[model samples]
Each structure stands twice: as C-alpha cells, then as structure tokens.
Target: MKRRGVPPALLDAFLVLVALIDTWANVGFDRGAPLGCALLASFALVLRRHLPLTTFLLTLPTALVTDAVFATLVALYTLSSLNRHRVLLGICALTYAVIDFLPWPWSNLRATELAGTRNVVHILYSVASAAAPVFLGQLVQARRELSLRLSEITEARENERLLTAQSVLAKERAQLAREMHDVVSHQVSLIAVQAGALQVGSGDPETKSAAATIRRLSVQTLDELRHMVSVLRASGSRPTELTPQPSLADLQRLVDGSGIEAELKTDLPGDLPPATQRAVYRTVQEALTNVRKHAPGARAIVAIHHMNGTIGLTVTNTAPTQAPLPLPGAHHGLVGLRQRAELLGGSITSGPTSDGGYELHLELPIGTT
Candidate 1:
C-alpha cells in the first residue's frame, strides 16, 4: 500500500533522480565504463525496497569503479533499515569501505604506497562514511519498532480496562440481588404468611378472598425474586462491595488518614441524598489517595460546592517534594470513581495543573441518584 503524505513510487523516482544527478556530477560523459556502471547503480534503486540485498550488490560496482557512490550508500541504508541481520550489515559496510578505499587495478596494490599517512586518513574517512548509512537506517528501524510496540501495549490496556469494567458491573448486580433477597423478599414473605393466616382465620367471605389473593400474588413475586437471585449468582462476579459505605460525615476522618497535608472546604447542604453524599465522599477519598500515591509530600486542597443545581468539586495537589516509592496497584480507583460519577449523571475531568501539580474535578447535578 502507498503511504500517506508521500507516495512510494514518487519517493523511489526521486531517489533515482538524485542518484543520476550524483553520477552526472562525478563522471565524464565520454568515459563509457564509469557512465554505464553509474547508470546501472542509479536505476537499481527502484528494486531496493523489495530486494535490498540484490540492490546493494548491483550498486557496489559503481563504488569500486567510479567516484559515484551515492546509489551504493542509499542501497546500503535501505538494506539496513529493512533487514535485522547485524552480521550481514556489518560485512556489507566493511566491503563497501574496502572497495571505496582500494586502488582499482589489483596489480597496482603496493604495500609501501598503501602505508602512506594521506592514504591511511582517506581509508579511515571511507570507513566512517560507509558506516553512517547503516547506523542511520538501523536507528529508523528501531524507532519504527518502538512505535509498534507502544501501539500494541495501548490496545492491550484498553481490553483490560473493558474487562475490569465488566467485572465491576457483575459484582454490583450480584450485590443488588443479595439486597433484594435479604431485605425485600423477607418483607414480602412476612406479608404472605400474615395473609395466609388472615385467609384461614377470618370469617367474612370478602376479607378471606382478599387475603387469599394477596398470598397468591406474594408467592408468585417470591418465585420471580428467587429466579433473579439465581441468575445474578451465576454471573462471573468477584468480591462484594465494602459494607458501611462512606458519607459526607466521614470526610474529615478520610483526610486525616490520607497521609497528605490537605484542607477541605465545602458549602454542601446536610440533606443531600445518600448516593450523592457517597459520590462526593468517594471522590475526595480517591483524589486524596492518588495524591499520596503519586505526589509524595504534596499539599492538597479539596473544595466542594453546590450552586445553581450543580455539585462541583476540585481536588488539587502541588508538585511532589519527594519521589514516591513504587506501590503495586490495579489502577482501577479512577475507573471505578468515574463509573460512580457517571451513574450519578455527572462527569470527571482530571489533568496536570500549570504549577506542575495534578488536579481532578468532579461535576454532578444536585440530588442526582
């Protein structure tokens, strides 16, 4: 497939054009061998992507026979970028340096002449230049691989988040089932028993018939409740939620135990619904927990307000004064808190502050269930 922004065919054509220009600048038009070899190297770039090794081999003759080595360098870079064989790339680069440094005719290789200072410097320069393309290509390959790894990690984390959310929902449903069975069903059973006693003991026909109807309906309701309880228990639920949930009254105790320097200020009414109060308390709890975890020794401010039918909260923490010790966590606190806020018809917004601090904001409508 063609790439975005720059088409592959166009890029290949451009590379070939540059190679032709290099050849033109280096070789005289009257020299038949140099011109033919340089042209062959220049045209070979079109096959570099599919057959990098073959392309590099095709271009090597130009480096050996003439000064037009641009095509050879480009081909070497292409091969290094595509192939993961370090030994082969090293050999190819060394061979290019040797070909570029040596005298053309094998018979003219004199030991004393090759040992000169100027020739030695030229040889070192040739080796360095040959290694440049290979290094650059490998760097590009590394960056490309890193990007792919990061993408895979991000996708995996998203799947894990979804699973965690499903698990949380299943547990909540199971808890609801337990509540219905232990409380609502118990009350209904009591009413059914009382109705049965009235049906058997009452003398009035109308009252007896009413009692019988009530008992029958209550029994049917209990059967449906049992079925629902069974279905909920069969679901893949984890542990039950913690009992005796926190409330606004527990805000002070939560902060005192949070291990961070924090100040709480709020103007919320005392008559808020239990769920709304719990949401606020949990928001403060989670925010303070994060401050202690991520921003060690940082001062925090928890400000909550109720104005114009909106319950707004802001938890802001300063930059860490000391590095925090690494702690094992499921990283589910914020996910669960967000789920709670969403259920209450609200939203959570969080990010870094301008003073190198982190802030979390929760906005919920007043009296939301």
Candidate 2:
C-alpha cells in the first residue's frame, strides 16, 4: 500500500522554519549586507517548487557572503528534483562549491597559491556537500516514476484477464450452438415430416385432425429451435433478429391449438402495450399447457381484465375427469412465465385451488407496462 506523507502546505512551512533557524545561527541580526542576503535566501525557499532556478539564484548571494548554507543546498535539491536538464544542475552545483571554498580576502590569491593541501581539502569537502542534495533529489524523482509505471502495468493485466475470460465463454457458446443445429434441429424436422405423412395417410376424420394438430406443433417447434440456434451462435457479440412473438391478438389461436378445452375471456383496454400483452398471453399459454399435461379432460378459463390501476390475469382449471398418464416434462414452463412477468415489472402467484384444480394469477401496473 502507498503511504501518505505530510501535507504540502505543512511541509513547506516546516522547510521555511528550518531555513530561518539556519540563517539566524550563521548570520545573526547584524546591520550589514551579509544579514540582508541571508534573510533573502532563507525566505526564497518558498519559490523552490514553482521557480526552482530563481530560488537557487537568490540563495547564491548568501553562500558568497555568509556561512549560512542550508537554504542554498535545499534550493539546489529542489531544482534537481523538478528539472531533467543535467547541464544546468551541474553548473549550479559547481558554482556552489567554488563560492563556499574561497575565503573572504582572496583578491590577491592565485590558482598556484591555492594548490596547498589545506585549500584542496576544503575544496573537496565543499564539492561533496553540493553533490549530496543532487543525488538525493534524483533518487526521489526515479522512485515517483517507478510507482506510476507499476500502476499502469497492474491495470493492463486486469484488462487482459477479462478478455481471456470472454474468449473462453464465446467458445463454449459456439459449441452449444453447433450441437443444437446438428442434433436437436434434425430430430425436430423428422417429427414434422412424419406428422405430415400421417395426416395425409389417415382416412378417419378424427385421426386426420389429430395428425394435423401434431404437424402444426412440430413445425412451430422447429422454427423456435432454429432461432435459438442462431442466437447461441451470435454469442451476444451483436444484435440478432428477434423472433416474432405472440401478442394479445394471437391469444385465441393459441387456446384453440392447445388441444384442450380452454376459454379466453378478456375485458381489457384496447391500447395495451406489446410487452404487457405478450406477458399475459404467455402466462395463459403456460397455464393451459399445464392443465392439458397434468389435469387431463379438465376445462380451463383464462380471464384478463383491468382493475383499479392494474391489469389482472387469472387462469383456472376444473378437476381432471380421469387420471393423467405419465409423460416426460421439463417442468420449466411456469418458472419461465413467472420470470418473464417479473421482468415486465409484474408478479405471478400460482398454486392448487381448494376445488382440486390449478390456478395462476399475474398482476401488472398499467403505467409500467
């Protein structure tokens, strides 16, 4: 985790206070040029961040006139940390060293005379002092750069991980779509073809009607399967054409083709929305389907009406006249219907009635539909 440091304002104040103390110790409050330059250098530290070069120039006069060197060293460090030009930093450091090494009365001194061992030692110490702050500042700048690069690297890795996961999911969906096309569609097509043949071959009126009904249902199932396969192949990468759905207008046809005695009594507004109409139609279809499979020979009533500000849909069936035969079923029709209703901001409640029958209720707000 990254650690927080002192606030910028507070740190700047602390630096100025330290500079003032250094000024007082080396160049006391004497009425002279040395004291004035020292005071200017100490306060110039305030401009180090915004005007680092200017701050260094202001502090140079203090280094030449007095022994108070803390503010000058700080100004040099600040310039080094903020600037990328090495030549400018080198010139500043060398100037600082030379200024601090020469004594007060050096007008008569020559380079050959300064070749003494004591003079050389003092010059070396001054150079080292000037170089210390530059090195520390460079280290700080490098650390800040490294932190930024690490954050960028972490973000790139997260994006790569998400892309890899999506690729795997797309592959799985493609495989499923292939299986549906190759196996399920082929089987359903054969059912439709056989039902067609039976309808034509049968001579009895009732048998022919039954065969026709079977063929119609088989063809409908094939259409839905084809659409589902196309959707799986798309893998949601782009928009796929929506299959035509049954609205309120198709409700009567659905009940007639259900192969069950179902009555659809609707007292609804003429301006019902497509989504609400679809939901109601689907709920009634599922209810009648259940009555046919689980409650054979039972009569069903589908009632849809507007009550208060809500639209109410109810499907109820009487008790079966005979025991139903065992049949394979996925039992997902009602669950799917309830989920669809909920998606449309509606609710569904379904259970057995006290008269030994099944009933499903759906309620939806007119405004939300």
Candidate 3:
C-alpha cells in the first residue's frame, strides 16, 4: 500500500507543480476570476497522494468554474493510481465529462444555444480529457503489481534450489560414511584377529606384548567403526538400534580369522581410554589391510608403546614374495583411518619403506574421557 522511496509530501508537491503548469498554459493569468479558480484547483493537488478522493472532490467545483483541464486530469490520475474503487472512478470521470462539455454557467450560454456539431466535438474532447489519465494510472498500477509477483516467484525458486542442493550433499555424505563402514570394518577386524593370535602363540615376551597391544587396538577400532556406522544409519528415517560394539578383548578372534604371519609388541596400560584404544586399533588394521593388498605373503610387525600422556603405534611389512591379488578396491581405507585418528586428536603417517615394503605410524594423545 505504501509507495517505497517516494515521500508522499514530495510526490504531492510534484503533482501541484504539474497542475500549476497545466493551468498557466491553458487559462491565462490576465483573467482574474478564472485564474483564481485555477490556482485553487492546482493547490488542492498537494494532498493528492494522502487524500486523493477528497482532493478530487474539492477541485471538481473549480474545474467546472474555470475549466482547468490539468487540475481535473491530476485528480483523476491520483484516484486511478490509488485504485481504491472502480465504480467511484467511473462516476467521477462521467461527472467531469458532462460538466466540461455542456454549455453551463462558465460559458454563460444555455445548452440549446450551442450548434449540434460543436456540442458533439466538445463532448468527445471532454470525455478524452477525463478518461486518458485514469487509464494511464490504472496501467501503471497493474505493472507494479506484476513486477512484485515476479520478484516473489523468483525468490521462491532460488530458495527451493538451495534446499535441494543441501539435501543432495547430506545424502552423499551419508552414503560415503556407509561405504566406509562396510568395507574397512571387515579389513580392520581381520588385523585385530591376526594380532591376537600372535600374542597367544609367540614364545618371546616382547613379541607377546606387541601382539596383545595389536589385539586391544583392533578391538577398539571395531567399536568405533560400529559407532560411526550407527551415526550414518541414523541420518535417515527408520532409525534402528545398533548391536554391542567390539572392544580390546575381541582382537584374538579377529587374528585367528586372518591367514597372515604377523607379530605385535606393546607396553601399554590395560585400562586404556576408549578413544586411544580405537585410534590404535584402526591404525594397525588399516596398515595390515594395506600389507595384504600390496605385499602378499609379506611378514608384518606391529609395535605399540605408551609414553608420557600418549600412545604410539607402528605397523611395518617386509617385501612380498608374490604379486598381490587383483582385487577391486574403493581405495579409501587409509584416508578413512587418517580421518579417524585426527578426530581423536591424533596423527597417522604411512609410506613405502626403503626395503620395498610399507610402514604406517600413529600417535594419539590420551585426553580425558
């Protein structure tokens, strides 16, 4: 309803200026009575925006008296622009037309005194004068409404696009998380099992200690992996409860399942925090999986050591005796393991060794549970 940027008072003043110019050009200043009436009609335009109907009614008498065409046109334009009532506008236009064309008090002549052709010409001109501004004002109002509707539609479509993009991104992330859970969890669990077997069968005290550390780490990794999977699954609807997660104790079963020659050495507290345990497990699991894939028939060594407020793990494999199996892989195991370590305030590094093998190392801080 409110006109933006254009002050009502300023617009009214502009309308007054238009009315004054129109009156000056049509009704000369030399004619005192007519000029005075024209001035009165022009001055009424100052309130056109605020009180358009009232201004139009006030100027109607002056328009009839002085025949000030511009003042009447200004009032009609103001009424049409406001677009309050079509019936009222039509009535006002009709009244002005009748008064302007008919031979009345202004012409000091009766209607019968005018010639038929002259009366017809005067009627047509008066009708056009009354109708032209109203038509233009209505056209302007329609265009403004159309522009506002288009703007709203454009904004709605943009918001819809933004929401759709966010939904697609969320779905992609959930899918990636699910894939990682399925592929890497199995490989990591196998590493834990292998480490557990080494701890139970090895004769050397150092070797048994290392095996124990690997088993514990693998079990913790399985637990965290399950938790991550649960989070992914919950991202969608149809939420389901997760099964009990693995712990340090489950590493032996994992090692027994994997057919690989591996050794583990560890000097860590039995009551290690869950986060550190999970980080160590994932590191060892990812390293062993990489060894199996890249260095078939290679012997792997896993060493775990606890220092001041931190735990360190190193997994290294000797050169393979045979070519690795040609297996399709997503190639995201290492990246996922690294991400896991970082999430737990830890770091992991891996590279090919000088001996044509591979080695992975991890260091995790033991933050408060």
Highest lDDT against the true fold, candidate: 1
lDDT (Cα, tens digit) per residue for candidate 2, span 1-369: 677989877877888899888888888887499989988998898888999999999999989989999999999999989888989999999999989988765685687868889888898899999999898888888888888899889989989998899889889989998999899889888988998999899998877887888889888888898888888899869999998877888888999998778888998876788888888888887888789889988999998989887899999999999899898899899789878878888899988999999889999977765
Candidate 1's residue-wise lDDT over 28-106, tens digit each? 6789988999999999999999999999999999999999999999999999999999999999999999999998876
Off by over 4 Å in 1: 1-5, 28-30, 236-369
Sorted by lDDT (best first), the order is 1, 2, 3
C-alpha lDDT of residue 83 in model 1:
94
Predict model 3's lDDT versus the native: 0.79
Task: Return the TM-score for each candidate structure.
Answer: 0.59, 0.79, 0.56
**Better model by lDDT, 1 or 2?**
1
* Model 1 clash tally, residue pairs: 0
Q: Which candidate should be chosen as best, given TM-score against the real structure?
A: 2
- Candidate 2: regions farther than 4 A off: 1-10, 24-59, 66-71, 85-88, 103-121, 244-259, 270-282, 321-327, 336-346, 367-369
> Where is model 3 more than 4 Å wrong at Cα?
1-12, 25-37, 103-109, 113-115, 193-203, 215-369
lDDT of 3 by residue, 201-270 (tens): 9999988876886787788779878877777756655566766544455454544434468887877776
